[model samples]
Target: MSATHALRSRLRALALTAGLIAAGAAAAQTGSGYFRYGDARLSLAHAIAVIEEPSDQADERRTLVFLSAQPLDAAAVAAAFDAMDAVREQAPAGGYVRLCIAADGSECGLFYSPEGFNSGGYGDLALQRNEAARIAGRWQLAEGDFLGTPYDFDLRFDTPIAPAPGSALPAGGGAPGAAYNAWLEALAKGDVAALRRMGGEDARGRFPEDDAGTVKESLKSLRDGEPLQARIARGRQHGDQAVLWVEGVDRDDIRRRGRVLMRRTAAGWQHAESDLSSVDE
Candidate 1:
């Protein structure tokens, strides 16, 4: 073949390869990737935006690709996140938020970053991701080590998270919210009776066994192990229900956050489980 003809053939091949690459890039931006699970039709990118925006300040840094089982229900999931966000903003303080929605439309994995980390701290990226996944209802996934230290986690969810039906509790200095703050203070002082009295009956409904033994044990672990140092990021209220963010430290001493759902009963506001409800401290 003539030299000129050979050069032309090579140019054509290069063009074809470039086009293939561009197509792949576009697919990735649309949430195509390995380990994609959940609602097959949901737009992972959109859901990710809903969870990551407040924390990242609206600039999306990466893509989330999940093979979904539900149709692209980005609208509903995003709405849920928005409702939750509105309630969180009502809190006395604010913090960073991250979330992930499953494709089936029944679950979401999430977490928050509390105040104080902006100054300086270790970047516990793996724990942050794992915790968020667990919060979003990915309990079935096996626990395994993340980063170097021993750990266990999975982001696979087959069930739905409790609806984050926006806050419904009364604002400051009322029964439950104020009472909850008192519980925190009392807990710090190891005043178990004060904690019990402050906790409402309905609060027991959602908590494990709704008894002092369970809660006291959990609180004790926090007091001794991680030493909960959290900023009251925010609180939300809607009717008798509420949510709280106690931005605490992660395993690596980084400022990660946890949340609790408040359930109000006849006596006063009670505490329930939230994504961060399982946190040790």
Candidate 2:
């Protein structure tokens, strides 16, 4: 062969080899699963894992989410957990499967959609391969009827774990203890005015002007039949944002723990998000 022709043939071979390598790399990063709820069927195309830190109320957990329509990057996965409502509202025509795994490798939660299937009667979940960077598993649930609808689920995934998001900002600044304490006190006293003042925009919106009495009753019922005596145990703050971990016991002898996300404003720290759950001894 001529030197020029030989060179051209070599270049074509190299290009084909490069394309095959790229396709293989893409395949390695992807995973597959599917489920059917009632008559709706969906296929999952991507898998990602997110690590959740231990809260004052709950243990550390890892969540594996399978996406149906679109692939997600690490930041997008983090954002999905942070703002799930927004993600759901903007989600495309496909559904998702979420599996929460505890630190000890047990399945803690399973959820899927197309109407929801949160009722947990999981039959089998086998994690044949579990590693730091990769997980392969199969999940199965027998056919059953729920709330008048018939459904069944089965899923399998084999994918690399997307890198965990960076650690949270270091705990600093004065814990927003005062605001949290005041909010709790107001809740106990049924003081609508104080509660409104300490609540952030999202929290304040929950209190409707036309339903003051209902709001008071709702707040009163939040404490159950006993009063809560919670206090902030620790906190982390960065700029205008902060999170406080609270620990305490109720009058009924049940331990209550929670975490509150706070945002600073002209009126001092206000509650933006709060989650409190009881832990039984």
Candidate 3:
């Protein structure tokens, strides 16, 4: 064979291979539910977004999470780590696609990508169906400068909405609420031992002899010289985890509100953490 002819044949073979690779990629992108970030993409298989009824007419936000077991790239793992570090919350193992939507379905506040977390106002969101039993939504960001990279994001999800776990109950009534009330009592009485017990194995040696005093001082600084006096106003328990909302009056008689997270161990419900803020009267 002539040298020129052989070289031309080799080029044709390489072109054929490139075309085949492109075709395969195009096939991967065709699906019912998918998340695409830059050059990588994932097929979302499941979704969960529960909308809880607001208590006391407060603003409520709902989270819609779409998960895909299909592997994307190494960047997905890095993105999960970034989310955990940025929010101090645990991220799911597989491809994690999340959106924080307002209760009225007016807007989406957050969007997750392989690059990292993106705050509100970067994309166009559309909700095709938003209901208690199911939800369908799409988020698209135009191809442009995003997070110092020339990339874009697109996610389309359609999946059933699972019911939010647990039942809501009045203060100090249900089991979880009662447990929260007990925790408040222990904290007010400066009972470190009881606090440790309520904290479960994770809190076995966490509290020191001066821990109660330290906590009180911290509360005093936030509560205007008053020790924390709170009562669980509502609660819900789902399996081993529970959330209890508390309402209280501070030293200045100002209203305060917070939530307590609890985990049920063999010994019973154990305190996980609490977050409190002053409520406008």
Candidate 4:
């Protein structure tokens, strides 16, 4: 070959070698790149895109099913977990497959974690009779790839409630102690007027206007019962608003613990909201 032709050939060879080296390096960094199952090959990003987020954050209990035509890889499994912001725990050795609701209300896609079960049993993603077979129809499972078909799942929601913040009868303040306490006292007294005075003009609109009448009916039933006392616990505070763990007990020994959210208003204080809790119930 002529000298010029030899140099051109050498340059082409050099370019090919560089391209191969670059491709090899790229593959190592991303761990096998796009996974190939059978007919379908998907990148990690694409695989994760298959799952969709649920509608309500309050709907914490959710289960998802994935029917895999074949075994899955670590990366594929990790991708599935990321879709739900969940973790996985190893199935306990020789233990009964524990199937239970997850704390975050999500089942683990693979392994169980402190939060929930990872895999196996009805608790994990349940498979349809032929779901995996259906997926295998479109694409066979391969060593490097994963395929999942749709399946049904449900969540057992443990009811939840927010804790109240704490507040005290500010320093020497009395009669109108803590905002929450004042509301409790007014409630105990069947004192609508007192509630309105402390709650401001908005009081009537705020409380069940007609419900104020019911307090007397309730009091009449308990006339022979003990007087009510307000106790606060697990107190937490935020700015002018304070939440209190409140409880009431009567002569009959009936007890109930609740959360009361109170805010400091110009009139003194007012109750913002309340709910029953098991802490002292």
**Candidate 1 residue-wise lDDT, 1-281, digit = tens:** 99999999999999999999997654331222112122111222211223322221123212121222222333233334344444344331223223343333323343432321111122212221223222222222232333333322232322222233354434442454565566656657766566555555632332354476777676665444332444555566666666655555534565544555566777566544434323334
C-alpha TM-scores of all predictions: 0.36, 0.69, 0.63, 0.35
Q: Which is the leading candidate under lDDT?
A: 2
lDDT of 3 by residue, 1-281 (tens): 99999999999999999999997654332113555566666556544444433332346535444444443232222222122232223344544666666777766564554546565777788888777566777877766465665545666766555455456665574776666667666766657678777866655445655576665654344336222565666677666777766678766677766566677888788777655566777
| TM-score, cand. 3 vs. native | 0.63
The residue ranges of model 3 lying beyond 4 angstroms of the native Cα positions read 1-46, 52-58, 67-94, 144-147, 168-171, 209-227, 249-258, 275-281
Model 2 TM-score, all chains together: 0.69
lDDT of 2 by residue, 81-170 (tens): 253443356564676767766666778777775566675546587886677676778777778677777767677777666653333543
Query: Model 4 over residues 1-281: C-alpha lDDT tens digits?
Result: 99999999999999999999997654321111222323433332111112222211223323332222222232333233132332123222221111222224333333222223243333233222112111111111123212352222232111111111234543323333365566556666767677666654456654555785655554454322322665654454555665555565744566645555466667656666555433234
**What would you estimate as the lDDT of candidate 3?**
0.58
CA displacement after TM-score superposition, residue 144 of candidate 4 (Å): 30
Model 2 lowest lDDT segment of ten: 164-173
Ranking by lDDT: 2, 3, 1, 4
Candidate 3 local lDDT, residue 82: 26
lDDT of each: 0.40, 0.65, 0.58, 0.39
Find the 10 residues in a row with the least total lDDT in model 3: 74-83
